[model samples]
Target chain A: MKLKEEIINKLQARGVELSDIAEVAYHLQKPYSKDLKLEDCLVAVKHVLEKREVQYTVLTGIALDILVEEEKVEGALAKIIREDEPLYGVDESLALAIANIYGSVGFTSFGYLDKDKMGIMKELDTTKEQVNTFLDDLVAGVASAASAKIAHQNKNKELDEAEIS
Target chain B: MKLKEEIINKLQARGVELSDIAEVAYHLQKPYSKDLKLEDCLVAVKHVLEKREVQYTVLTGIALDILVEEEKVEGALAKIIREDEPLYGVDESLALAIANIYGSVGFTSFGYLDKDKMGIMKELDTTKEQVNTFLDDLVAGVASAASAKIAHQNKNKELDEAEIS
Candidate 1:
């Protein structure tokens, strides 16, 4: 299945807004790429998930369910999660393996943003009334990984220019 | 008093290692022109701290204390904490602050070393002991900031060269 379609199905299963799925996927995908736009990264994530034969929808649904149950994805997302919600754990590392194809930098960014920027935390924080303590570390990870990516990109650019000259 | 000396004293009083004091200060100081050596940054930080009258040592010391008390410092340093502890909470950020004076690339090396190179975390993990989580962020921050400093220094150098030429 197409990654986007897969993500959509997963979100649909999880009772997340059809609109929220794209935004969530985009957040998950963005810190991983500097060369790619947010949409491209999202699309790429979808691609990698499919290539790996991942049940992306199932995995994402489970993750969302856990987040909701644990009050990590509270408010609107929580309201949607039903007793019939799938039973599974999100092997985020597996999902990240798909992103690592882009680079470790992407993986780190994914981890960071996942922890910090997903807005689910904010949603969870206000609605579930839980603290987003994990967010700061996640932000730091993204930043640290991004720094590596930035340096690597700069070095690669230097090499490319050198070759061109 | 010179900023370097002030910072060093504060750090020592706060229980920072003598070895790390100057490097931390170097990382925290303003950019030096062209020179990328630790010494150059140390000198620059000392100079700037003096000029600005900023008590960087005190500031850094407090930050270190917070991170340490939070159990954020890890890896080799964490091992050091378990044995022959020079002090607690003198972390990657302090080290990076020292590096930041030199350039951005310098901190990359530190972060790279902190993650892949440091063997302490593996051992600590196996032992089920808490390794410093904050260290990695500090290292990353130092590298990121240093990269910024290097860019700034490069710009200044180019301007100076252009003016002279």
Candidate 2:
């Protein structure tokens, strides 16, 4: 498997979503990786996922599940799940959740990606329209998550080096 | 037509997904509004759908559209549009995208609803598995979007009142 996919699978196996993994992958791919490690990235992802600031993704997910159980929205989410709606609309939220892990800077980066559709998404050229908006959010979530992750990693790394001294 | 159905048809007519409307409905009924007017709710719904914060949903939807066009995620999101798959995993990014709108609070609420499976989602029991994780993300997106919608409405109302003054 490709490195990105490998990372994605590893995270997913740990209960992280593909989008979150992709967000981390994208962030790690930047020059920042020169100063970070895989463990750092893992911690960053964990921090954002559990942080209070960006918990809306988890909250919304729960609510949607409830709606589905109640057979609300013509069982729309259920229908989407049951019939597997071809052009699903949930990708944007997934992407944003990852980005929100970082911070507002992540939001800025997300805006750029959504407008640009850089990398793999642009190549897809699918009729699905929410790509820019949702991807922007996803990128932001990833960035936010990474920001916290990076900070935590730096703190721990510094402490570790000090201890080694 | 039932209130929920009416909302669903309106969303479908506008090319919005049933889940999207269902999500809006979820917020429309809860803490956000004790006696929410359909028209007012519609306004809030449109606000979120049109707001840049909610763009993540749009972007994910578009990606799934592309994936469906290319035949990826065969049993999940891609199939939902084609009306073929029995169950489709929602694109992870989409859910996150929506959650980012309301920050982490909304995302957490989504998770709670998904895990509990209360309200409209109860109808989905016979049709599919519990889908706690996926639903959590979806609910986060919806709630975040709804929060943004509510925020926008409050802002607009404030602006209108200010103008009258």
Candidate 3:
């Protein structure tokens, strides 16, 4: 399968659908965009996923989570990751890379999703059966980037209208 | 020349030295590491420069700055970039990609350096003659990643000491 498909499959296996992430993105952009549709958010999420950096981050995080599940990771790092330790910042850092591609709005959106644990992010965070240390943040990253993309599009539309006037 | 050397040369041509970036990194880490040396920071900066993502970001940002200087970029985007508009968040977003590799500490450090605009970052930000719309944030990103590298090392050292006890 293609890398994007592979990533999607991986997320699906982890109980996260792209639509779930899109819902979060819609939530973030709704206030800013009066007529925004959920479909627009879904398209933005897919566009964000097409990025190589985002794909690599998702694969890497998922692979690590799998390793933890298999008990392959060693020592202190393993324990920290398995427990999703509050202070272990690497997971969030990896996710930040995804959001960073969009803009400052991306960062702010990510910060909010991360802290608020909205939608699928909250579900991932509360799940104890599997290690989701990185997946939770990755979900937030995608949602944040998608939201930023919609915001940028909205801004460009306004600029275009202004120029026409 | 290799990709690494090519990136270094590009920065040198743009009037930024690795040591200048190292100074910012050292400043960020000094409060935490009593024995942190400037050389250590320099080494960390070099290490960050070695990453493909960082190298690509630096080259891309510099290339755009050069394009703006040569009057190649068109329309409102060009004007926004040339003026270094405060609301143009893409520059900082690109830089955040470089910092995201390290961890959450890297994000915080990048935020601080971007805001304070110290050392070479300050010089790049204030140079009215040149379009440094992206270079300033790139500098902050490098310094932040280097600082985070040192911080991670220090944390590992503490963990080792604790385990030994």
User: TM-score winner among the candidates?
Assistant: 3
lDDT of candidate 1 over A1-165, digit per residue (tens) = 444465455444434443333354445544544564445433433444343223322332244334445544322223323231122111232334333444676565556555465544345324433222222222222233333444455579889999999
Arranged by TM-score, best first: 3, 2, 1
Model 3 per-residue lDDT tens digits across residues A79-141: 999987644888878888898677685775676566567788888989888999999989988
Q: Which ranges of candidate 1 are over 4 A from the true structure? A: A1-122, A135-165, B1-14, B17-19, B23-103, B108-162
CAPRI-style docking class of model 3 based on DockQ: incorrect
For model 2, the superposed segments whose C-alpha errors exceed 4 Å read A1-157, B1-35, B51-93, B99-105, B128-140, B151-165
Task: Summarize candidate 2's per-residue lDDT along A29-130 as a digit string, tens digits.
Answer: 455547555555555555555543344343333333333334442323345532324455453445554564554445555555555654443432242422
**lDDT of model 3 at residue A77?**
92
B-chain TM-scores per prediction = 0.37, 0.48, 0.97
Identify the runs in model 3 with alpha carbons over 4 angstroms from their true place: A1-87, A90-165
Winner on TM-score (1 vs 3): 3
**What is the lDDT, from 0 to 100, of the residue A87 in candidate 2?**
50
Give me candidate 1's TM-score against the actual structure.
Answer: 0.32
For candidate 2, write residues B111-159 as lDDT tens digits: 5545555444444323342222233344345655565556556668879
Which 10 residues in a row give candidate 3 chain A its minimum summed lDDT? A107-116
For candidate 1 chain A, the 10 contiguous residues with the lowest summed lDDT are A82-91
